[model samples]
Target: MKDENIKTAARLLLGTGLIFAGISHLTFARKDFKAQVPDWVPLKIDDTVVYSGIAEITLGGALVLAPKKYKATTGKIAAAFFTAIFPGNISQYVNKRSAFGLDTDGKRFARLFFQPVLVYWALKSTGNVK
Candidate 1:
């Protein structure tokens, strides 16, 4: 397959994952998500989760439906979004908060490695990266 086809497939997959995760954030998994919120965040944990949920939904939809002409810009925004959320992941690790089966120090530490992958995925999947 061609590179563009791969990118399109990746973009769709990332968008779907985000949509599912966003829904979970607002619904069944909300309480669990709160565990990931950093103590340093100024807002209430619940509020932070809700706002991030909304952001995920919006960004995911954009990734799925954005015109080809705007893919790069959308990808840039998505990458930035991923960067913005790195703190929560770090908090989850640093605070040793257990959620989503990341109960052990090794698991939590390993999970930290995935953030940059997500950021790269967002950029590469939308043609923002060469």
Candidate 2:
């Protein structure tokens, strides 16, 4: 029961964070987010940011509201979403784009490691892992 409670709290926290991030992507952080978009992506940087923002909002809502039966599936999807955006983190590091105060190469490199943690968070928070 305690473990369940912990998972619940973690899930809620992750969901809320994602929602906030999504909003920032569409508004205040839009420009900053563009710095992460890889040059290889065909879409305009703005469009990619907007689309990803929308996705984050949707996934966040799912994580927050999904029923027990759906939580695992939602977690899996969220993990995939995190994985999908990983290249953007890589782009920020490789291209030397400074945003979110990741001005130093070491900082950007460190940020890359956080993506996997997010994936694990999504899974573990939803009880996808023991």
Candidate 3:
């Protein structure tokens, strides 16, 4: 596929993934998501999860529906959001808390590597990187 086509495809996929994840956060995965919240976080765990879910839904929808002129801004926001949540992922790993079947230390450790890729995806897919 051509470069723009590839980016469009990636952006669409990322948006869909986030939307689904946001839905999961509000519904079936509420408890699982709670496990991902860092213990040191002062906010109520469930409330934090809900707020993140809402943010995910809003950001995902923006990625899919925002006009071309706003793509870069949306992408930057998405990237920042990804960066913001990364500490939760680290908490999960460091605390040895398992959810979504990332039970093993290796699996949790490996998952940490994917966060940066997600950040890059948000940037690249919206043409913020190129």
Name the lDDT value of residue 33 in candidate 3: 90
Clashing pairs in 1: none
Query: In model 3, how large is the Cα lDDT of residue 105?
Result: 97
Per-residue alpha-carbon lDDT of candidate 3 for residues 1-130, written as tens digits (9 for 90 to 100): 5999999999989998899899999999998898889998899999999999999999999999999999989999999999999999999999998999999999999999999999999999999998
For every model shown, the clashing-pair count is 0, 0, 0
Instruction: Give the least accurate 10-residue stretch of model 2, judged by summed lDDT.
Output: 12-21
Task: Please give the range of 10 consecutive residues that has the lowest summed lDDT in model 1.
Answer: 15-24
- lDDT scores for all predictions? 0.92, 0.96, 0.94
Per-residue CA lDDT of model 1 for 10-95, tens digit only, reads 99999888988999999999988999999989999999999999999988999999899999998899899989999888999999
Residue 83 in candidate 3, Cα distance off native in Å:
0.2
Q: CA lDDT of 69 in candidate 2?
A: 97
Provide the TM-score for each candidate, comma-separated.
0.97, 0.99, 0.97
